[model samples]
Target: MAQRIRVGIVFGGASSEHDVSCMTAGGVSRAIDAQRFEVIGIGITPSGRWVQVAADELRDLRKQGGTLPRLSESRPTAVLLPGQAGGARVATIEGDRLTDVHDFDVAFALLHGPFGEDGTVQGLFEMLGLRYVGSGVAASANGMDKDLMKRHLAASGLPGCRFVTVTARQWSQQREQSLARIAGLGFPVFVKPARGGSSVGITKVDRVDDLEPAVLLAQKFDPKLVIEEGVANAREVEFAVLGGRGGPPRVSLPGEIVMRQAGAFYDFEAKYVSDDDAALLVPTQMDEELRQRSADVAARTFEAMGAEGLARVDLFVTADGRVLVNEINTMPGFTHISMFPSLWAVSGVGYTELISDLIDQALERPVGLR
Candidate 1:
């Protein structure tokens, strides 16, 4: 019998999206192929402690009652140590004693938001010479920052929503000038943390009176902000992109996020808290030409961002038929119900096969300086 590959499923993080990450880990754990891969659950606590989690424990990660799941610090503390010959190992730490050291082959990082998704963890993996799923350090960093992502897309000649960036220093030093630049985007702008995800720190401002308060709220999540002009009469659609094996990246059929409530954006609450506010439609109806155009743009966005393994490209389809790029999620939500998996499912890839394919992709890639 062939040896089962030991896969490190890294989840949880010191980000606002930590709970979401935990949920994603649970979903992946449930769907991943058990016969071919040995699952090693590695979770990071909200306070930034790495701990080893059992497969059963990861399976139980879910929202109970109204509370989202969090990693318990009580689990044995864990760490990833550099291995000989460009590989990695995982071991548990008890006080000052290290034990249960095991060879860890590939890392399926299910972490979302800052510490994990913004290239910090990727950089660590690079230094350790370990191959992992998702984009490399530079691509992960660019995808995490909305301001940089938009700028990158623009430089690649892609269409995006009109927006302005405001850093903490700039906002404080040139308050009036910054506000003036934002005002140029007109009212009804989306104030968002430049590097935050899962809609944790986003606010839709209808007028100038609400703009500053929205900016302040977003600043709590990230010091830099990207306030974009809201697309009028636009439908929120998303596409899932997966790296091809020795070929171009693959783009899935589009999915649509339909907000059931009037004037309610797809906020954090709508995403995780309430289930009735938003409906996910896979293989959403679209003109053949528009669909092709959207897919082309999404694939281009993934390639231009230098993303690898997998990514989710979000786009806004205006009623007038203009398709504008919203942003690319290098590490998108992987829950069974998440749009990324749903899009692929409709595109003929089941959840389990999708998970297996991603692991295979990671294993096929070279570790260093790729």
Candidate 2:
């Protein structure tokens, strides 16, 4: 029999989405094929401590309770050192002894938000010459920053709503100027952390009076904030793109997000905690032509951003039939119900297959520039 591949699943971080990342890790660990791969769970605490976790523990996280699960600080500390071609790579310290763990052929990073998703971890992987899943450094960095993402998408001919990027320095020193520029975009705008996900720090403001507070709130997650003009009577649609290692990007059938809460947006609660309140309709009710267009745009966005492995492209379809590209999540949520894997599920790739395919793609792709 062929040897099983050693796969390291990394999750949790100092980001605000730490709980969500843990959930993602749980889902992935549960779905990964056991016979084909040997899995290792690595957890990063909220305080930036790295620890080793048991696969069984990671798989049972969701069954815990209402409160989110976190990586406890009590776990044994883990240190990573490159393997000599094929040997143990992880070292755990127990008193004066050092125990070496198995070497990982590939790393599946399920972390989200700033420190994890903003290319910091990806850069580390590059430095370590390790094969890891998801986008490269530049793509991850651009995907995390809304302003740069919009610019790259726009430059690639994708249309989106008008937005103003406010840095910490500008928001503090040129408060009036920043507010004035945002005002030009009109009301009913979304104030968001430039480098956040799962709608962690986002606010919808319909009046000028609420803008300042929203901006300040968003700034808590990221020093840079993006204030975007909201599309009136627009439907939120998403497309999942997957590709790498010589193949062209394949976009999944578009999906629509319908919020059950009255006048409520898809915020963090609506996405993770209270996600049952929202419905994800695969193959949106839009006309076939529009669905095709959305898929095309999503594929283009993936290629333009140089995204590898996978990405979830969100779009706003106006009532007038115009499609506006919203943003891209290079390392999107991957729970059972998360749009990235769900969309692909509807497109015929099951969750387990999806996870295995991502690992295969990472292994096939080399560590350096292509």
Candidate 3:
């Protein structure tokens, strides 16, 4: 008989995308193969506190609204310390006295945004010599910052929209100049927190008159900002990038997101709340050449950023058939209806298979400064 692998599915974080991360963790924990591995659930509150939360508790908190998800413990909480410490890596709680339950061979981070997805946590894993799923430091950092991501995409010879990076300092001191600079990007701009996800602090400003307020709105989410030249009446197409240790980046069939809302684009509400409202067309309605081109851009974006495990590459396809890379998420959404998982599912990889493959990638990669 073989021993089971301890897998800690880390979720929830200090980021604004905390709830979404919890949901992702729940879905991942539920789908893991019980017979093959031992699963542990860990949650970090929006206040940046880490604790071990049960799978049921995470789901329960979601059903009951307004309550900030609670953490069970803080002291000696579950930390996937390097297997060097011996015993089970998952710090288990048998009513207070921490017990090593199973040696966590790998971690599947269902975390998103800021601290979790932005390479901060990934850096910690690197220091501890622990293997974890998804992109590493460079890839995670690039994926988190919109402006940096755009530069990498263009330098890789991939098509991308026009935009300018505005630091918090510049926006604070040179307000008018920053706005004027963005005006050169044309009207109908997208103001987004350079390192945010789940549409937390994104605003689509149609006219230059409404640009300043858009900057202020995005400033609330992140200090750095990226204002993009919106593609007028363009189709939102996305592709999934899956890569492991030696696997070449594989792109899934493109998917298109149709914004049915009254606003200029898919905002916070249009993303999670109105999933049924927006039309998510799979195998995006692109000519064979354009479709292949979109996929090529996605693959290039993934490789350019040195993304590993997986990424969801989003692009804006114009009415005249030009595809522009929008952004990349190292730890993209994994919900059943989320495009990352949906595209993979339609491409012949089931949710369970997708989950397993990510873990396989983590375990295969040797954890270290490498």
Candidate 4:
């Protein structure tokens, strides 16, 4: 029998999206192929401690009653050390004695948001010469910052929504000027933390009066804030891209998000808490030409950012048929209900197969510069 690959599933990060990462990890722990891969759950506590999480503990963390689960620091502290044969080993430290856990053949990072998704952990993997899923350091960092991401997208000659960014220092020094720049983007704009995700610090301001407060709210998450002009009468659509080891990436069918409740965008609650807030339309009922165009743009966006393993590119399809790229999530949400997996599921790739494909791709990829 072939050796079962030891795959370390890292989750429960030190980001505002910690709970979400735990949720993603729970889904992955349940979905990964048990016959081919030996799964190890590494949970990072909110205070930034790495600990070992049991498989059943992860499985029991299912989303219930709209409450998200988080990793606690009470678990045994886990450490990753360089192995003798150009690899890494995970061990658990209990009291003063240390027990060797498992050496990872590859890592499947289920972390999201800063510290995890923003290339920090990727850099650690690279330093340890351990191959991990998702984009490399540069790509992860670039994809996490909305401002830098939009700049890269526009430089690549892609069509993206008009946006303006304001730093905390700039806002403090010249509040009026900052507001003026944002005003140019017009009303009904979205104020978001430039380096945040899961719609945690996103606020949609329909009028100029509420813009500053929204910006403040976003700044609470990060020092930099991005204000983007809302696409008029636009429908939110997403396309998933998966690849890394060989030819061009594969683009999944576009999915549409229908906001069910009035005055509710795809906010945090709408995305994970309240299922009735929105419904997904897979392979959206869009014109064939438009759907293909969106798919092509999403693939191009993924390549432009130098993303690997997988990514989800969001787009805004206006009523007039204009498809504008909204943003690209390098390490997007990966829960079963998340749009990334849902899009691929509809595109014929089951959840388990999708996880397997990502691990295979990561194993095939080299750790250093490509």
Candidate 5:
């Protein structure tokens, strides 16, 4: 029998999206092929401690009592070390003593947001010479920062809404100048933490009177903020991109996010907590020509971001048929209900197969400077 590849499923992080990452890890843990891969759960505590977790412990990760699940620090502390041959090794430490150590072929980092998705962990993997899923360091970092992402997209000639960035230094030292720049974009702008995900620190301001408070709220998550001009009468559509085996990336059928509530955007609660607040329309109805155009743009966005393994590209489709790049999520939400997996499922790839494909792609990818 062929040897089963040991896969390190790293999830849970110090980011505000920690709960979401745990949820994603749970989904992947349950769906990953048990026959072909040996799963090792490495959960990171909210306080930034890495610990070993059993696959079964992560299976039931979900919201309870109106609170999202979090990783427990009680599990044996875990650390990654360089292996003798190449790859990486997972070592579990109990108290002051080393408990167990195992070698992993590839790291499937299911972490979202800052410490994980923003390329910090990817850089660690690069230094350790460990092949991992998703984009490389530069791509992941660019994809995480909304300001940088928009700049890259614009430089690549992708159509998008006009946006202005507010750095912490500028906001404090040159408040008047920052306000003037933002005012140029007009009202009804989205104030968002430039490096946040899961819509954790985003506020849609319809008037100038509410801008300061919104900026304050976003600044709590990230010192830098990217306030974007609102796209009027636009439909939120997303496409999932999977790296092709020694070929161009594959694009999935488009999916639409329909918020049930009036005047409400797809906020954090609407995304994970209250399912009734929004509906995910997979293979959402679209004109053939428009669909092709949007898909092509989504693929371009992925390539422009230099993403690998997988990513989800979000676009704003105006009523006048203009497709604008909203943002690209290098490590999008991956729960079963998340749009990334849902889009692929409708595109004929099941959840299990999708997980397998990502791992296979990561394993096949070259480690260190790709």
Candidate 6:
């Protein structure tokens, strides 16, 4: 029999989305083939400590609010040595300094937000000469920041939202100047951390007066900020693109997010906490013309960003019926109800099959300056 591949499931990151990352890791670990791959859970606490955790324990961590998962309890811990070229390695620390070397074929970085989802972790994988899931370093970095993403999309002729970058230094040094620059873009704008994810520090400032404090709130999360020209009552649509053009990439049926009674927008509460704060219309209610156009935009955004494997392209349908790329999630949510995997599931790809397909892509694709 062939040796089962060892998978290092890296989770828990030093970002606001740390808890969400744990949830994502648990969902992915549960779906990964047990007979095909030996799963090892690596938890990185908010303080950056890399501890090995048992699979069941990882799931239990998610149910901190008096909920429970369907698994027995066991705690596992491991240590990660820092270096990319020698490849990622782990040591099982048990008892009084007793250790054993445990290597994995590839790592499943189920990390979200700044430290993990951004180019940081992917850069390490590049140096280590290892295969991992999601986009490469450049793509990961671009997708993490809304400002750079818009630039790449515009340069590639892919439609995107109008926006400007506000550095923390500039905001602090000349608050008036920064506010003037943002005012030029118009009011009722979106103030977001340039390197944030999961909409943790996103605020919609309708009045010019509210803009400064909004930017300040965003600055708390990241050193950089982005204020985008708000798309007025634009329908929030999403389309999933998988694989690359070398082989035919599949576009999942579009889904629409209809905010019913949530925060002013889809904030952290609406996205992660609220059970049914918004209505998600899958295979969205769109005319064939708009549907096809939305799907095309998804592919274009993915291509323009130079993405590989998979990406969830979010768009805003204008009042006049044009689709504009909001941003791309190179490594989107895979938790049970998350859009990334859920869209594929309804589009004929099961959870287990989706996990297998992603691993297949990582294994088949070569790791280098490609």
Name the best candidate (by lDDT): 1
Candidate 5 per-residue lDDT, tens place, 22-93, comes to 888888888888899888888899889888887688777867787778997777678999874447888887
lDDT of 1: 0.90
Tens digits of per-residue lDDT for model 3 on 261-330? 5444776777767656578887666799988888988888888899999999998888798888888989
**Model 3 regions lying over 4 Å from their true place:** 54-80, 85-88, 92-102, 261-263, 275-277
TM-score of every prediction relative to native = 0.95, 0.93, 0.89, 0.94, 0.94, 0.89
Query: Per-residue lDDT for 1-370 in model 6, tens only?
Result: 5798777788877666676778778877777777787777777877676777766765455545665322222333456654344246777667756376667777789877777767898887787787887888999899988888888898999887778888978888887888888888886789999888778879998889888778878988888888898888789999988986366568999998889953367778878689777778876778899999999989888888888888899999987998999989988887877888788888998888887787777887777866
Q: How close is candidate 6 to the true structure, as a TM-score?
A: 0.89
Per-residue lDDT for 95-200 in model 4, tens only? 8877857777888888887888889999998888888898999999999999999999999999999999999999999999998998999888899999987788
How many clashes show up in model 2?
0
Among all windows of 10 consecutive residues in model 2, the one with the lowest summed lDDT is 82-91
Q: Report the CA-based lDDT of candidate 2 relative to the real structure.
A: 0.85
Q: RMSD in angstroms, candidate 5?
A: 1.9
Residue pairs in steric clash, candidate 2? none
lDDT of 2 by residue, 161-191 (tens): 9999999999899989998999999988999
Among these predictions, the greatest TM-score belongs to 1
Worst 10 residues of 1 by lDDT: 82-91
Q: What C-alpha lDDT, on a 0 to 100 scale, does residue 85 get in candidate 6?
A: 43
Whole-model Cα lDDT of every candidate shown, in order: 0.90, 0.85, 0.78, 0.87, 0.89, 0.79
lDDT of 1 by residue, 1-370 (tens): 5888888899998877788889889888888888998888888998898988888988888878968899877777789999765558888987898888878788899988787888999999998988898899999999999999999999999999999999999999999999999999998999999998879779999988888889899999899999999887789989999997889899999999999987888898888779798998898999999999999999999999999999999999998899999999998988898889989999999999999999999989998776
Candidate 4 or 6, higher TM-score?
4
Clashing pairs in 1: none
